[model samples]
Target chain A: MSEYQLPAQFEEFSQARKEGFLRAKAIKDSGGHIAGTFCTFTPCELMDAAGVHPVSLCGMSPEPIPAAEKDLPKNLCPLIKSSYGFAVSDTCPYTYFSDLIVGETTCDGKKKMYELLGRMKDVYILQLPQGIDRSYALEMWTKELHRFKAALEEKFNVTITDQALREAAELRNQLRQARTALMELQKLDPPPFTGLGLYKLLDGLGFSFDLHSNLKKLTDLTAQLQADYAAGARPVPPGQKRILVTGCPIGGVLEKTVKVVEENGGVVVCFENCGGIKPTRYLVDTQAEDIMSAIAQRYLNIGCAVMTPNSQRMELLPQLVEEFRVDGILEIELQTCHPYTVERYEIKKLAHDMGVPFLALDTDYSQSDVGQLTTRIAAFIEML
Target chain B: MPVYSIGVDIGSTCAKLAVVEDGRTLVHQMVMPTGWSSAETAQAIYDQLERQGYCPDSSPCVATGYGRLNVPYAQKTVTEITCHAKGAAFLFGTEACAIIDIGGQDTKVIAMADGVVQDFLMNDKCSAGTGRFLEIMANTLCVDPGTLCELARRGSGVSISSMCTVFAESEVISLIGSGTAKEDIAYGIVESIVNKVASQYGKLSVPGDRCYLTGGLCESPYILESLSRTLGLTVTSHPLARYAGAIGAALTAHGLARSERRTSV
Candidate 1:
């Protein structure tokens, strides 16, 4: 066992998460399968129904990035490098226990990295259309979703019935509802919890996989928050501005930037990134006659940079700002992530049109730029 | 009764102390090398003030810069970005302006409007466009940085190839060994520093008309002239440009003191 222990509040969830990896390993030892995924584009519903545990493991540390130097360029996205590094170095237990690794064509860097990852592990790549606005894109993605379902069924030797799929979608919906309740507490002026607190809580959801228990914990935490607020207690101190961070996922790997914002006297009330507020932002429409199409539609509507002409993302930003009562918007772009970097101009313009102050910071996972990041964030807060 | 405030800016290379009264009149400003201990240097400055019958300890004290938190006596610690913006606004009026500050270790280009910091960009990791970069190049050239600019004024067009401080230092050594004129090399070094700074300044969305320059490098006339010729904007600097951050912290101290007094009242 690792010598390190988590904070007291996170103990229950952390313990449950640690036990999950062991249980999944035990099941794999008994001839069961565990599937590892990268992006959210991989449908977890299908895998969950096939009696296979689907785990989203986006590599977050820079420790393994140098190991990837032999094959990949030095300037590739740190997220992909860290994930590939973990796999190559046999550092990630989830990737090791995974019978199959599922990947998506989210960005160019990830697309090529998947091809290289295939040589090291059993891998399946799902193709996603770049432009969601095109008429054929929806039909194309639906077909891809069907192929994903078939691939899981064929590999695991179990048929996923419509009832099983519906049940999986229902479980995911419960997780989303729980997450929404947690994010809603941030709307309070002096929120009951700090932004870092909510970020950690949401980050735990991806790894823990114990949905029912995690939901209970989230519900209990929110209840405690309500009671605290009722008794005139506030977690965020006075003079702290509410900040909304939107950009590529920090992936719970490198939180240097978020910690800088918090430490410099600002509260990050909401996150629009894949890792932050996005995972629980939407629920699958199980009521649709064709449940597969429903799943495809819900996930595709996600405001990911992978989607070309992503106006829906722009449409969603102002609403999030209003809902979260955000004071300022910070747009962070990971170094060399072309899709998000290309969208920088539009995002800034959107923030301007909405009458909110916006700061665009391009940074990486390295600790080298921490001071610079702190100065910029502190200045942004001073403006608000 | 006249209330006083003290602001200390413990920068990477130098520590500055400013004393202000009623948030307007600047009573005194002092600058000294930060050396090994910035907090001790700051405390020494306060001790000197106390010896001169100025009770700085009773006043609201504020600190800024990399070593801000080190000053145990400070009631509050603010970032240099905010302090710089406040200082620039005090010097120039409350107009929309951009302040380009080149410190020993970090270079900052901060935007301000209506006496508030709007946005800022800092290059702390890169030493190419900073005061430390020039210090290294000057030491290698065997010329004092204060006198290097005067020497550069006598020479005409010669270009330095590298922007990296270490590489530039080696290039200077090579140029000296190859019988290149020291004056021309000095001019080339100034040009290289200007070019490095201009590239980062170009990233700012602010207009050039309102650009104000601060920091230790502003003390060199030839370098400032080169910057003007390169950027085509008559960049202006305050007579007390080096004390801007300290003055900003002093202003913050004054405001905090008044607020606390009001709440107590």
Candidate 2:
């Protein structure tokens, strides 16, 4: 390890995943219900309202991939393969302890993988619409959320009242506000944390189960970073090209993409991917007459490539570029992920229109492409 | 006393060295086969510089290419993509143009404006559109790369569909077994490479009409013609195009040396 280390807050967040596993196991031991979720589109408020612990089950490693390949094809998305592999190998504690797994028809690869995952665990598939422009899309999605609520109620033997839903919505909205505040700290001239450090904290938040503690930790970290900045502490050097990363979820390949960018004289100031600002940018409407419909609208509006026309992503990108003062845009598409790969052309054109240099890279979860990634990222920094 | 800058490019297949005076005048240059080890090749380059009366201790040096980190004496290291763009701009004397560099392991399409790189695209983690693809096909056909290009010019009306180098080799074997003309098979191989490169170039939004070719295969007129025909643009190359990466590194070294001088004063 280098003599320079991440801040104590960052270290604690990095340890959240391992500690979360034990916390989740304890929850399961005490006859508590845990719901494993695969996409940001999953209504965690519904699970929270039913007094169930909602854990993100999207795999972020290459270890369980080979076991997944025994049942799934080799050329599918690595994220899908890793997620299914964990379920088949019985390795992930979250997947093992979950009373139910909630998946959505976001992409072809994942929806198929969920079919196989259902054999080992109780899996519920939510029929998601392809686009948000149509009138019936929201109605169908709201109905899906209702079905999901019903499923949760039947499985856990608990009634999710309107007041409970409202409370859950308010808590989730607070978490989003805390997350947004933490991420916005990168707008500082010289950011208080490295992009890698920021990404670790954001990715780690998914594994943490307690909503109140998660909100508290996020606000505390944001406050600490703001205080450090005011005290003349700059973790990232000035004049490093500020980069905005936009593409598929990058947790599995963060070391290759985000770490390489920081090491090569570029600091990723913003992430438009699933775990970053994409899902957290909107909040469920606690004051809506229909709380379930409000939750559906918030999730359906996420700027994921799975949506046709994907206008939300196109709309959100320029705002991030302007707000983050990005010097460059780096889009990472995992191999065989057709939606992000195909949508990259539009993103590149948008970046060009905004007069920022764009670089699109396609990679998998393996370490085989690290050298190439370094060279590409280094050259990009040099160009900036 | 005249100061000089040295640029060392340790590519996958060949190592090139260039010495420049004041960043504009090329004072010395050499090329050697990068056999087996890059560290050894870097040492050999330094020894050759010493013998040529160039002081490696005083000159500012920049290393580039796949083995750039192996150059122990270099003051800095830059990636081949940047080096190639800078060198191509200097050689072509055009600020607004597109460059296609077919390296041994990678093929890069770079767009430049005002003598700086605007955007670039490189082939994915495959040898489909690279110089290595042509080299492998040449070896399978029992001919050197140069002779293979020469033969490809004489044949017509055949194409290799496989995008993978390994699959393409087997396709070549089957074609040869069925008494297909060697020249025709060679044409198919070169055509496949040209098509792959052209497809990558098509994705890049360059500024101007000027397109230049650089790298080891730049000397091949047949490739230049095929690339131009496929891309629907005139693809041109210079005799020193193969050394573009080294020259770019040398230019960067000149900048480094000038900055150091300014800091010292």
Candidate 3:
């Protein structure tokens, strides 16, 4: 048998998981016997601390979900079907690993989904009480936060002092600042970081950020990236627009469409890859009177992937364009990627209305379409 | 001649067409599969329209279903929940109805208040409790929707222990191999389907009297016969059931078109 390998770090799938996982682990890993707290988010962080890795289980085998169709509405997205299928088949590995499956009330689908799946004994839900903009909402979240913290304390019998959270916050701040620097660096003449390299560095943020020595080591690593660059000492080709695309890589086609833009004489600086945003954008003041409230304020208020009443994807477009001072935003679209496709439609309408001419490129992010996207991107840049 | 309304339901297995005149369905039919090509699917629909000798282009066409977006010529895309509720209310003439629609891909349980959707839960991830589930069960039993419904109506008092299609198929296969009655197994399959519907409807505060089911699953007499079992009250099945979504869309379009003409006048 191969030697058992340990993963470098543990990560929550979404921001919600980050908060909930930390809550559970902060108490549990301290080795206390308190019952676990429930949040709407899954238990990635808590699991990691418990020496369990939480994988975001998205798809299903289609075997069990077909039966659930009788019990569920037809208009629901496929994601929920898989959730039910997972439960019906007992297919979720995390089911054994997870002490608590916390869920946020983001939509009607997730709420119903959790409720339906709550047939299992241990999974708990920390619903985001209604009245999103109300003070009561804030109070509710704060109370939930405290309750969650207490549950962690009770479960693991660990006393997480305010000081620890402050330390966590400071570490998070450093990571974010480094990310901010990386963002600024993208504006340089030839652009400093490739989207792929930027995503990898951002991915390395969450685990090491909690440990100061590790974070210091990371800071040294980021510093030496400059040396690595200096060592290579190669310039980008002339007459090419050093543009970074700030778009979510949705379909498998993101790379294909990206190649298209590159061929079109534009170089992609970043994808605003969710991986880049999550670890690098931890903006909460963990030292506040209510750490949970601070975290919520940081996450909900930000125009990131989870903070959506509107697809603030376009918001990233402008920032990346001006920072990178991109010649134009080549909005690569997958014909069926509903979220981005709709966002592209609005972006196009707004571009036309505002006279901010940006190219909207549509192709099934197929590798075959790489040459086509590159050609179009080259033309859009030349037009500018 | 008065201006009329129409509803179009794009289901997984079929494209259902419904023509509503004065909030009532005059004609309804289900077309075949939406082929691999969108244009081919659209053309098949177009040909069906020409065969029926109706000009869908002349009317305001509101489409509903998983393939609602794929309906190239739809004027608007209304969710299946809204369309189902409208169809149920139009068919049953009831203001408050619990509309359970079991199509091929998913099952949706919707609570309708005066032909408007109050809340809904969709089972987009499963083939259980849906028309597709029935298709599988029927294949196991060697029957179609028409014969399966008849068998379900004719039989009673059997339980389908499994919900997983894979296991259920095996169970049915084993039962047939063992010498279990075909009617009993069919009844069991239909009952399990009803149980699945019951699980979804259990979430909503569905009223006892006004519960109706639409879509191909309802085409099974055995399933509806099993559904006749009470959920604190009686559940009724309508004849125009499966075609309800398309009828609602057509009716909605017809009404909208009439209002537009009235404003112009």
Candidate 4:
């Protein structure tokens, strides 16, 4: 391993979740409202405008899966099982403190899991369109945003004004801009931070509700990294094969995929997954005539596998490959994630056309396949 | 003095060693049961090399396979995937071909173009499509793997549906209880593994029509024929195909030795 140490901010970001739990408890004690979101499609601006804090409650651990399997099928996606498991077992403080939990019809597993989740908590389901190419997708998503806004107002008893929505959108856009700038720093010859470091920071940002503090921390970390690099600190060794990770959300499989890749002659320079460039690259247009429609449009354009004909992903992949100077593409699909697993063929074809080697690994949040994953990833790095 | 390069492949079932003279000639080869401990197997391989008048410590050596890390004397270690691809390419004397290596724990299908691995796929963490699956089924049938394949040649009119080795073993026991012919049950076992391998091969977009077979099953003509028939392509193997991983490791050792000499000069 390289003896280079990550800045203190990376550690601080990784601990954000634990700190946020205490913060959420304090807010609840003071009679403040908190909303829990499960997907990237949630219009968090509505929650912000209604004086409610939105915290991401997507499950990225395997501890609660067995309990979830009692209610959910054993063959379902681990993310769904984990999320449902946390809620049913009352293990997650965020879920317990949430005034309302927002869910979107992203995939079959999550859609059904929400049905059961709704029975447990104050759940509100947003009917998301499956395809972005149709004209009705934007209109329907816009209407859903309005409905979500009304739900928040009714539950919190605070009417959200258009100016408040616009202001919330502007603050969220600035946060996104800060995240994008930090992510693009990996485009350097040798990335300033390892993929694990970058992932921790990005995943940690979702739990942090203070937008201004989050933005400041990101910029400060970016500056620290740049100054260190200028002073001849290369955290990643030169000549390691640059890898770009794409597919399902990678928080559950980070040790098996990203960490293994880095341990064996390669460095993960880019992550096109949910927590990385995918959701951060697009910003809500705060200046549009209707801020709700602009927010809906931006969220609808996410390159998720749930969307049929995910052209945004197809388009973004090649651009990322070139900009990152990627030598290989590794797609990590969780077990039973049908949309990403099925979409792997198209991603492979795209990698092949671009003259890059691609490898797809289907795994669950278990340690049983670590040996096999190590050999496969090591051989892939050797091939590059 | 002539400097020989050594390749050691400590697989799950067997350990193979190859010594190459000046990177081109196959000067010596050896194979032995891997036993329960890879570290002991590696020690035995070293002792055998010393008895054969080869200085393992002095020679440039590369270790491979699942137990590659256990070889203490190896100068470097490479994964079985690259070693197998390089060794099969050398044995078949072709730069562009697909290689299917069925080992004790896993089955790997690799596409080689211009003497490099273009793409590859392995069976998921299951023993269904691998050589271990056959061995377990053979044990249940009271026959060795070779005899089971031989029995498969004459049997027909039966099939095994379970892809899992343990489940398939129970399925075979039930067939025995039902008075199903041993030959017919044997045929089902071979068919199950052959079909699994064929399906895995179908997943890769191989570059050439030529496909090569390597590993322990390479010596079984019935397996070769069954795989060839199932894939609709002539899957060929040589007598030394089982030693491809070791040979590839030796070849890598040769390259490293040559480069070190150049740098020293």
The candidate scoring highest on TM-score is 2
Pick by TM-score: 2 or 4, better one: 2
Q: What is the full ranking by lDDT, best candidate first?
A: 4, 2, 1, 3
> What proportion of the real contacts between chains A and B does each prediction keep?
0.45, 0.52, 0.00, 0.42
Off by over 4 Å in 1: A1-23, A252-255, B258-265
Clashes of each: 0, 0, 45, 0
Sort order, TM-score high to low: 2, 4, 1, 3
Query: Looking at candidate 4, what is the lDDT of residue B100?
Result: 96
In candidate 4, how many clashes are counted? 0
Output the better candidate (1/4) by lDDT: 4
Whole-model lDDT, candidate 3?
0.57
lDDT, candidate 1, at B151? 83
Q: Candidates sorted by DockQ, descending order? A: 2, 4, 1, 3
Candidate 4 ranges beyond 4 A from true positions: A1-21, B257-265
TM-score for each predicted model, relative to the true structure: 0.91, 0.95, 0.46, 0.95
User: What is the per-residue lDDT of model 2 for residues A132-163, given as tens digits with 9 covering 90 to 100?
Assistant: 99989999999998998898889889999999
